[model samples]
Target: MTTSAIKPLTVLFFFLAVSLRGTNGEPCGTSSIQVQTINTGETAAGGDSVFEVQVKNLCPCSVRNVRVDGGGFATTVGVDETMFRPVDGGVYLVNSGEPIPSMGAVSFRYAWDHFFQMTPRSLEVDGQC
Candidate 1:
């Protein structure tokens, strides 16, 4: 084949190889949300304290349907009241309803009321099939 023809074929093969190697559609993995403090060790009768949780997308691909559960706390308060609620809480559902880019992260702050107790929080992030 002519040198010019060979060049195009080589370029095409290279492009395909690179694209295949790119990170995409990876499986969901567990990533810890850094909790500054798990518990304050103080309980009030009618007051609340703020807590912070970090959610990270550790997968090589984007993640979607991210849901965070307060774990043991949820069972105590029930599902309706267990969702994270803070006046200025950073934890929230991604409104875009799209994938969280790989390695991207978001922080959430929640107000734990007297009725709510601090517990290990778990995050469930769904990925595209």
Candidate 2:
């Protein structure tokens, strides 16, 4: 083949190869999680109180061995266990052996009687593979 024809064919082949690859130019071995609150409810302490957490996988591979912690209510008196098992699938109870699929989401709910009176506490939900 002539030089001009060969060069064009080489470029076209290279482009096709790159494009056919999954997520071309996307960084591999990278993942992310997004957490959000979905709902709230009234507490017995005459205040609005409830906890919801959403965990999302933003990676190409599945995440395994996920654990959540720090979902405790902090009050002037002291910290207490106000979190409970998810009444629904949106709220995920702790599962040490389950694997979170790639690009998946899980959520759960928690309630507190004196959430407002408590010292604005935060929950730390973590996941691992």
Candidate 3:
């Protein structure tokens, strides 16, 4: 290809890459949310296991109304409602429907016989994006 043609192609490819990286400030999706559970080295009074759960938003923009699948979730220890609230059958809301800033995380503790499988179910991108 001619030098001029190659230059324009290079520039076009550069812009395409930037746009794919969300240069337009588009919000990320639920897939960017990470949920991790770990043993906290403590046991509940009922002999259940204690675990710490951290829900992190890996997006560049803030997110609100983060929901997770809490199927069969139970805890002997009470978790703060503002941090994690059980709304319906096996569904929970995180951060009280407030914005979790970009790359921020929310955490809570629970005691149960076993760790429940929690996954990001849904979320709304905050307007700050």
Candidate 4:
């Protein structure tokens, strides 16, 4: 085979190997992610304040389909960021729509119409690569 043909073949094989190795749902390590509260529980009266949570992606690979589920928040009107979609059943799921790169972060801002406890009982990240 000519040198030029071998070059393309070698590159293809290298990419194929990388893709195969990154399979098995282990490319994005869930343990590498960290969630922190960015808000100090502001007082709200009909859309006056908000509660914020930030998720940092520390995985080696990009994390896609990142969703944040909030539990135990009684009155969550909406989210500040457009990337997040709030469900009707007190579940704020963030559809990143793109991959969260390594060492990158995505934050969710909760907008409430009434004054209530902003503490979420659980903040879970259902992210997939």
Give me the displacement of residue 106 in model 2, in angstroms: 1.7
Worst 10 residues of 4 by lDDT: 115-124
Candidate with maximal lDDT: 3
- lDDT scores of the candidates, listed in order: 0.44, 0.43, 0.88, 0.56
Error at 67, model 4, angstroms: 1.9
Backbone collisions counted per model? 2, 5, 0, 0
On residues 69-127, what C-alpha lDDT tens digit does candidate 3 reach at each position? 98688889899999999888889999899999888999999999889989999988888
**Predicted candidate 1 versus true structure: per-residue lDDT over 1-129, tens digit per residue:** 999999999999877655533334224433422223343454334345544444555555666545443433322221222223421233334323345666676544444552233332333455342
Considering lDDT, where higher is better, how would the candidates rank from best to worst? 3, 4, 1, 2
Q: Locate the minimum summed-lDDT window of 10 residues in model 3.
A: 18-27
Model 2 earns a TM-score of 0.41
lDDT score, candidate 4: 0.56
Q: Alpha carbon lDDT of residue 113, candidate 3?
A: 84
TM per prediction: 0.39, 0.41, 0.81, 0.51
Tens digit per residue, CA lDDT, model 4, 13-119:
87776653444435544456566665546755574567666667666666665544455554445555455555546545444446667778877666554433322
Which numbered prediction scores highest in TM-score against the true structure?
3
Question: Model 2 over residues 1-129: C-alpha lDDT tens digits?
Answer: 899899999999877655433254432222244455544564525354665555565655565444343345232222222322332223323333255566777655455543321111122223432
Model 4 residue-pair collision total: 0
In model 2, which regions exceed 4 Å deviation?
A: 1-31, 41-48, 68-93, 113-129
- CA displacement after TM-score superposition, residue 98 of candidate 2 (Å): 0.5
